[model samples]
Target: MKTITKYIKISALALVATFGSCSKILEEQPRSIYEPGFFETERGIMGGLTSMYAHLRWIYGQAYWYNTLLTGTDEVTYAQQADQNFLVMDLSGRALMNAENSRADAIWGICFSNINTANGIIEFAQQVDGVTEAHIGEARFFRAFDYFLLAQTFGGVPLDLGAGELTFNTSTTRSSVRNTVPEVYTKAIFPDLLHAAEHLPETGRVVGGVTKTLARLYLAKAYLTYGWWLENPNNIPTYPAADRIDPDGHDAQWYFQQAYNVAVQGIENPGPFRLQQTYYDVNLATNDRNNELLLYADHTETSEFYNGGSLTWGNGGAPDNFAGWMLTWNYTEIRSSSSSSAWSAVSSVQREAAQALGRPWVRMAPTIGALSNTFADKTNDSRYDGTFTTVYRGNWNKAGIQGPLYNANYLPVNPGDAILTFLNEEPTQAISYGAPFNSNVGAGVLPGRADFVISPSGVSRRIYPGLWKLGPYRTDSGSGLGEPNAGSTRPFTAAKFSELYLVAAEAAVKGASTRAGFTARDLVNVIRARAGVWRWDNNGNTERIEDNSAAMIASTPAEITIEYILAERSREYFGEGYRWHDLVRTQKWTQLASSYTICGPNIGDRTPIVFQRNIENFHYLRPIPLGQLDAMEGDRGIYQNPGYD
Candidate 1:
């Protein structure tokens, strides 16, 4: 990542107020009110350290872009197709143009921001008398972590080792993509991580400081990346040929083994942390310890509350609650009192909408169907239950009303328009539909009705039920009038612990060859047992589909190669940002090109819609933005990567 300079331009006198003791900490100080001299005091130094924590916030929050755009797209097979979503572009053969167009820029910005904050903290904390060595170690650990993110994203980013010299200008050009992947791993990230592992106490020492396990976790990830990056057989300095090799030509296996060793160390000496037991425990709202796997970050309730809702609209509420609309109600069936009666009333309207929209009412393509069916069969797997809600209908209640009878699966009885203006109009008369409701309601109130009548033929009348149960509102009437408070009382966002288990499983599988402590089959069985699978076995012949029930279980080690790992990662971490990088790292861009189909205004009938995976060059790199290139002076070799025109 390009290390952007952020000089704290505060007055020397005001610095005292800025870095003073926690009691004297300025809650409402002006942004420009800084006093470098105050930074000399113990309280001032601690205050400055608080600012570093704030910087860490940016890193944790910024992962959503990768989670949403890269992972949720065809980059990984985690996400199935959806209508009118940007991921469709990648899935449907769209070339990501430059850094400006790609969402990765936000990740770059967040990571660099973390690096700057760490640098500032390290530089300033050293000047204080009572400042402990542990504090300095923490700062260095964060700095290394920030740089690690840069390396993973951009591959050889400029390294900024120390605070800038007086001659350092903000306009100083980027350093050459110096430090090969191995060099960055060894010289920059590894040293800091190792130092952190040694000096940083146990996990509960502080809220967001580095721990021994976290350092190990990061080291494992870095080593894994190193192995992947180095295992290119086509490269000039290839390892001994597979046929001539002693261990069946498994060069990549060595790197995976290193990663595994680190992970095992972390697992054994997990400090104060431990894995979450249940699916609900992993969520930010409910899980207090956050999980043994989570290295650092504030474990406050606000962090939990802030992280909910869909990709389009953040944690849903009054003004910005459009995310509910973006959701296509296809997962569970929307059954009425009787299937025949509801279908008779609503099927024709649904057919018309399908014909006009040129898409199915329930957008379950072959891919989605396959995956959903697979998840259905894997009931024993904790991930299947944790990631998705299996219960067809949980108790539902009206927004303001309070009554046991009122709690039922409330499906929308109308579909007026795709736009929001049509949604606010509530349907009065209930239309009976089958498992998945597809009905519409009309506008305006009818006789003896307080709400708008269900249009016997409109789209709004169609039943599309949301998966989770809605929170209770204030009223006894079931008219859907009350709204939940944003800060308090809202539906919880489920982030299952099963994901952490999957990460552990992958690490274990990769590490099996080197450690001799545990085999891949053993790791797989552990996860299977957790999921309650009766047919669990370590025979190495059991095949498991990535997400779908239809995948043939692998019977051989060759079958459980990188592709299988990628598939498992997709199924386990879908919608959480694992797919995007997996696609790039595994050179599976061609598979991404094959799965998508696009339809919209700017896009015409682009047949055989697909993106070519330029793996030889483009896979490991992204093009620098043309606008940035234009703005920079001189050759600005910094602005252009190797293959761009």
Candidate 2:
């Protein structure tokens, strides 16, 4: 880690930041705010606010940063063709995440820049005419949002970025100091969120704008996280070496109670947000930006200007929604024979901009535990179907191949038939692994089946269920594969309304006093009940109308424990970038994600091998970016997180 001076400088440079449609169905404009007195004008305030929203693109949808969020978790691990960027984060004895190589570094600069812009807006917005409390409240919300993320990932961070604490810094100062965790929560995160929740409007002016509910969601989440820090039940260490004491004179239980109260309040006053009708609808590509999504980094298929990146081709960079590509295995390698007797194979499952098949980077894969254990009751639960693309259907006709051709077991398959299917469970008969009959992507052949089938236990790092929730979608494919190479145009969901229930339940389990009708078990059952409803069978590829809510509720334990809450959270938010933070907050990362089972990266390696993670106590907090250290003045040892230096 080395030291530089402009770390404190606000990045209010002129740029085109697109704000998604708010009051109108479609709206976009460029807003440029320069540093000098920019915040004194209404336009500057507006531009700065837009940048706050735009910064999410750099963090949420960016694949490398996404790797930081889930790669080492119980959900996923590094996949075939993974570079060091993916490998280091896996924490599985491959390599450690140093400051230079860590993709968590991506958030460091972007968040600080946005925090400075937010500081500018909050400081100067009152001087501008027509700047409402709501406007300033948005700034406060973003400022706290960034700080919350930073604190969670890197322990304590600098509040005074060369300007005094929470002030707009115009001067470039090299020196920086880290704030303690409690100081960050009480001084910056909690105060800002509380103010924003009170002053912000009930609903957002724009589709993904910050609203009171969104603010309260973060507020509750922050309180919950801080409470865990204060409790330190596992005795995990914190950086900047501060004691586990709340500056507000509140104990861990008090904060947990506050978390419960705020989450309950948000649920009670959900304004325009609510749970989608079914779990499938929540992450359906077409149903994106639905009522359940509180905030998202928006992109569109209509225009590149509005979308912020090329719609037809993505370079796998920031501002491009390409996190979908990471989990996507090369389905294009799936082969179907043109002849019945001869082993003449043709690529059948070509890459397409469908919800199931997209451009595959094969950089990350879900763990076997994620499939077999986490989603154990695959038959009863609809989440496994909704969350992943378990079956790869034939679309060779779209690629100009007439498939009345023979597939696995030399079975006749037509266009729109099942090409490759990841079986829900191990079949009664032994899966045929090697032959002229099997597919190249390590999928096995089941007797009398046209599709190449891989059992849940046989899922490899190279071939497994792709994430369907964040996959690509397009209306313009027009009887052919359309824009499979493009970054996903659907908005990347960052927050959901269903989390209020989970958050409240988690707090309740942590000894927060319960309110009537909102007990810990009651809150969790609401989510479980919704998981029972099904509008579509994702694996079977058919319409399935069913209401098994009572069954789902009956399955839930009467005494809801923290473990159950964590499991349910995984079921709901799997592969959506919540696992790491959730596990870290509960001090359950090492316990839950310490060891995972996955087959080798090579094709045809279906032998599951257990891999152990080298998740040290210090590994909980990600290393501070080496670039930040290079730019700062003074002892960088004091600035970086422990064990990284």
lDDT of 1 by residue, 172-268 (tens): 3433233444555666677777777677777523443456666667666766666666664334221111221222234666667766777666666
- lDDT for model 2: 0.87
Relative to the true structure, candidate 2 reaches a TM of 0.97
lDDT of residue 413 for candidate 1? 31
Clashes of 2: 8
Whole-model lDDT per candidate: 0.39, 0.87
The digit string of per-residue lDDT tens for model 2 on 179-233 reads: 9999999999999999999999887865688899999999999999999999999
Model 1 RMSD in angstroms: 11.2
Question: Where is model 2 more than 4 Å wrong at Cα?
Answer: 1-33
